[model samples]
Target: MSRELEALMLDHGADGVSFDTIVAAGANSAIPHHRPTDAVLATGDFVKIDSARWSRLPLGHDPHVRSRPGRRLATGDL
Candidate 1:
């Protein structure tokens, strides 16, 4: 899933992921910084995605370089 997501981001023009992709399911969902395991997702399990992407623009190119260059983060649960 992480690989797919990374590909998707690259395909969409993101320079790169800002950090490691996190996709936690069930028990792992409670952890904000869980190292993913090979656990298979089951029905009714809580899912969490903490995703971030670096800027497509080069550093110093974006006006808000410090805050915007590599700080995009998005979290979601299901």
Candidate 2:
């Protein structure tokens, strides 16, 4: 799911992902900055998704180039 989100970002004109996508589920979600794994999501588990993308621009032209902000969503919000 994380990989798919990253692909979608690229499809929407993002130059590349700013970092590895995070898709932490269940107890793993308790950890900050957890990396995605092949573990299957289970019932009652909370899922968190974090992603960031960078857009192409000339060097020193984009102030946010080196500081792309990331957005996060959690199942708890749903």
Candidate 3:
């Protein structure tokens, strides 16, 4: 599903993006962006999303560039 979605987004022209395609269950749901383990969901479990989509000009280009004066958030802290 993620591959298909990515292909679709690219085909439609997405400049930049980030994602967390978690498939968690049981206690894992509470772990946030949890990778599946041997644990299983019993009766009630849910998935979480910490995903984002962005558009920016590629380096040395004018398409994905940001035209602002604010400080860019450092990776992992954004």
Candidate 4:
């Protein structure tokens, strides 16, 4: 899912991800900074995504222009 999100960011014109994405699901969501794994999502589980991307602008052009988007998901919706 992190890979997909990274691809989506790139598709949207981002230069690249600023850092490794964080995708925590189910009990893993309780972890402060859980890294993404191959764990399958299940009903009643909670998911969290924390990611940031660099702008398409050239490096050093604008150090302050980063894109950080975060979201939480509940598998129950699936």
Candidate 5:
């Protein structure tokens, strides 16, 4: 899921990821910067995906766009 979000950013003209994508689900959702694991999401799990993308602009700090895009993809039966 995070990979797809990165690809979508790249497709939209973003040079690359400014910060690592956060795909926290269920209890992990409480953590804003949780690292993703191999656990499967459940039906009642609350999910949050925070991602930032940047361009190749020369500046003191890279210009970034932070967002939370939504996707409804199921890996298995609920």
Candidate 6:
């Protein structure tokens, strides 16, 4: 999702980028919060996304993944 985040940063006229896109899969979910690994994506679990952006102005960009109750996506077969 780095691409998406980069796009977002650019959209808000950010001057520089700080981190890579963090994407985690499968049991990595049990990691509480994790980053993307070389592992592939499968079916039967959930994907958690946590993103952040800091700026001088209130860009009104707030990530709300887990906050949206009941949103589901298959991550891997446990």
Best by lDDT: 4
Writing each residue's lDDT as its tens digit, candidate 5 over 10-77 gives 89888888777778787888886789798888887777777877677557765554444543333334
Q: What does candidate 3's lDDT look like per residue over 1-78, in tens digits? A: 334544555576665445634445545556755664555445544444333444666578755532222111221221
Clashes of 4: 0
Q: Each candidate: RMSD to true structure?
A: 5.6, 3.3, 10.4, 2.7, 4.9, 6.7
lDDT measured at residue 78 in model 1 versus the true structure, 0 to 100? 35
Give candidate 2 misplaced runs (Cα > 4 Å).
57-78
What shift in Å separates residue 50 of candidate 3 from its native position after superposition?
Answer: 2.3
TM-score of every candidate: 0.70, 0.70, 0.39, 0.82, 0.68, 0.47
lDDT of 4 by residue, 1-78 (tens): 889999999898887788988999988988879976778988989989999988745586765478788888897766
**Candidate 4 residue spans exceeding 4 A from truth:** 56-64
**Separate clash counts for every candidate:** 0, 0, 4, 0, 0, 2
Higher-scoring candidate on TM-score, 2 or 3:
2
TM-score of candidate 3 versus the correct structure, residues matched by position: 0.39
Q: For candidate 3, list the clashing residue pairs, or say none.
A: 56-64, 57-63, 57-64, 57-65
Tens digits of per-residue lDDT for model 1, 1-78: 767877887687676677777788777787878786888877677677766666545566762211122222223443
Clashing pairs in 2: none
lDDT of 2 by residue, 19-59 (tens): 88888888888787897678987766787777788776878
Ranking by lDDT: 4, 2, 5, 1, 6, 3
Please state the error at residue 52 of candidate 4 in Å: 0.4
Candidate with best TM-score: 4
For candidate 6, report its TM-score. 0.47
Candidate 6 runs further than 4 Å off: 12-21, 58-78
- Candidate 2 vs candidate 4: the lDDT winner is 4
Q: lDDT of all the models against the reference?
A: 0.65, 0.74, 0.45, 0.85, 0.72, 0.52
Comparing 1 with 4 on TM-score, the higher-scoring candidate is: 4
